[model samples]
Target chain A: MRVFAALVRQGMKVMLAYQWENYMGLVGNFAFLLLFSALWSALLRGDPEAQARMLSYVFIGQLLQNWTFTPTWELAGRFRMGDVALELAKPLSLPVRVLGDFLGRNIVRVLRALPAFAAVGFLMGIRLPDWPQFGFFLLSAGLAWVINASLYVGITLISLWTTYFDQAHQILDFLEGVFSGFYVPLWYMPPALAAIATYTPFPGMFFTPAAIFSGGLQGAEALSALAVQALWAGGSLLILYGIWLGGVRKMTVMGG
Target chain B: MLHALRCYLLLVGAQARAQMQYRFNFFAQVFSMIATYMGQFIALSWLTDRFGSISGWKLEEVILFYALAILAWGFAVSLFFHLVSFEDQIREGLFDRALVRPLNPFVQLLAGQSPIAGTGQLVFSIAAFLWATGRAGVVWTPLKLLYLLGVAVGSALILGAALVTVSALGFFTRRTYTFYWSLVFPARQLVHYPLNIYSQVVQWLLTVGLPFAFINYYPAHVLLDRAADLPWPLLAYLTPLVGVVAFAAAYGLWCLGLRSYVGAGS
Candidate 1:
């Protein structure tokens, strides 16, 4: 726990060093938000209510983007550079450190996004979620992060096989983004594609939580979403454990 | 001139050959690139499916505009994507190696990298273009075909100029990535959708401020025979002209920036 806390502190310090870049990233994020909001407004020209709901959906998705935007490319690069050999010699758990660092960075991102969220909420007239819904949203979001992280850990483990893990990451990253409804709400997706997305672990990462927060999924439906997320969370963690065991042996074969 | 062209060809060929060495990795990247872009297109289609036309532009028409932007950007980035790394080269004194060389630094930079991944984008865009054309039902006359060809070339040139101009500005500001992330990338992304959907101010910004609209929106409008819908109808015919002027300006800026280079750590 101390090691994880230290790692989180280290991540925050590193992110703080590049504060300007994060602000620039915020600007870029806002640009997309503006662009998409405009599109939705144009599409739902006559229906203000639906437009506002869709806007809220887009806003939540964009806010949670940093959480879902994992790039195992860094891990791949580390393996290629043999930096992982040194990392493996450490006493702490690799996956725990990865999660800690991600959490620390995300804490900063969420803090940075708060003002924008409030400002946009005022402008778009988005209502705050009720206490229970907010609780459900947080719970689902926590599970989503675990599933997402485990998915990335699984992706990073591909470094054990070949140096082309980055290429694989690029493909899976896009697939995850699309399948998870990061850009478009799953309810808005075609019936067929939405059905297909249900089979993937991605929707639990972004769509489920976003829907809960936006009040799109309520009560029983929201609970079902949480159940699905919890199932994915358990399944992905188990798969990650199995893969880590095998990947560690492969890592030793390569040197570390 | 002939000798320079020959050297450029040889260098580009060598780069391509070197990239093809990892056949499996190359194929995987290409396939992923295709899937990535195709997924974006699918998302757009689903949205249009749910809600009808966007600002009077049908799904097919929007797809046509999208394909044009993708093709132009694919052409530009495939050729000049390496320029994004110009800052590192300048900071690390690698620009000195180019300066000491007999060849033009611009040509050397162009030939230094391969663009196989962009080929996937190109393939997807072309396929989408065909699909859109069939559905949009545009009567392609010989003159229109010539105009389309001109537009494609011009759009590619404008995007390529945008890239070169940004990288050239790296000479003045060491951190061009910030400018790129905040400005260039966002502006470029907006072009993927129709400019008509945006507010007047945004349309003007995309049109005059950045000229990204000329890459696809105007050309698509003209080709779709919706010229009267444009604020200034004549703007539809200005893409090729805009491309030439932008490319000329970019070249001038590149020359000026090259002269400004005083070596790393200066």
Candidate 2:
């Protein structure tokens, strides 16, 4: 706990030093969200039902997408730089250390995003959920962070074999953009594509949580979605641990 | 000129050969690019199906615009990858090495790094262009064909100039990535549809301000025989003219940037 806390503190300090860049990133994120909202408004100009559903989805999806935009490339770069090896030499377990770093980084991002979110809400006339659902929304967001971090860490571990892990990160980014319904709602996707999205783990990262927040899904449906998120989170963690062990063994044998 | 071109070709070939050594990585990069392109196209297709038409442009017309832009962009990226990374090269004093070469620094810098991955985008763009052109069923008049060629060349130069101009900004800021993204992200939006689909302000920005419309939209509008609010039937030919202007301006900016680039740390 003490080690994790120390790492978090260190990560926070490093992030804070680059505070201006984070501000720029926040502004960029807000601009894109506004762009999407405007696009949705244009799309749903005539249809009230679609306007309500799409506005809800867009609002919640933007928030979820922003929340889960993990810097997987940064993690992969660290591994490529052999910094991960030095990190492994520390007393902390690799996953715990990565989780601490991600949490610290996300803390800064969340703080930055909050003002933008409120501003967007005010501008777009989006109403926040009542207290109870807001509580669940926050909880689901926590789970989403865990799922996203584990998936990114797992993907980065593949860098041990593929030196061009940045390529993988790019591919993953494209998939997230398409499949997570950040660019378009899953329900609005063609029937075939939406079916595929339903089965994929991507929805757990953004779509499913966004749906829950927007009150598009509730009760049993929301529970099932959370269950899927947990499954993916657990599966990703296991895979990452396995890969880390294999990579460490290979490095040890090669005298790395 | 021929000798410079030959050297450039040889340099590009060598880079390709070197990259081919990492067969798996090269293939992976190709596949990743294909996926990215496909994803964007899919999104555009979905939008077209939902909206029927954007402003007055049909799906085929929009795809035609995208195909040309993509092809030109692909060519620029592949041919001038080092120019794209000019900021980093300047910072690391790699430009000094090029300066020592007998050839023009611009040519030498372009020859130093070729984006082999861009070949995939080029292939996809060519395929898309052929398919979209065939589907659009436009009569290939001699004038139209000449105009198309002019548009492609002009578009390539304009895009290349824009990329280089952003890269040159690194001389002042010492950080090129942000500038590159700012240019690229907005440029991607331009390729999604015709400039006419946008508001008048956006049209002016794209056509005159950024001059990106010369890359595809204006020439395409002419070829399709579509009437534009802008007068002059010969306005389509202005694409190449705009390209020359943009390239000259970019080159001038690059010279200024070079003056600012102090070899190493201060």
Best candidate according to TM-score: 1
Q: Compared with the true structure, what per-residue lDDT tens digits does model 1 show for residues A94-159? A: 777777787777777777777877898788787878999999988988888888888887778777
Model 2: CA > 4 A from native? A26-31, A52-56, A59-66, A81-85, A213-215, A218-220, A251-256, B1-7, B81-84, B194-197, B229-237
Output the worst ten-in-a-row residue range by lDDT, candidate 1 chain B.
B174-183
Summarize candidate 2's per-residue lDDT along B37-91 as a digit string, tens digits.
7777777677767777665667777788888888887877776545656667767
Misplaced by over 4 Å in model 1 are A252-256, B1-4, B176-181, B259-266
Worst 10 residues of 2 chain A by lDDT: A247-256
What lDDT score belongs to each candidate, Candidate 1 first? Answer: 0.82, 0.72
Interface RMSD of 1: 1.5
Angstrom error of the Cα, residue A216, model 1: value is 0.7
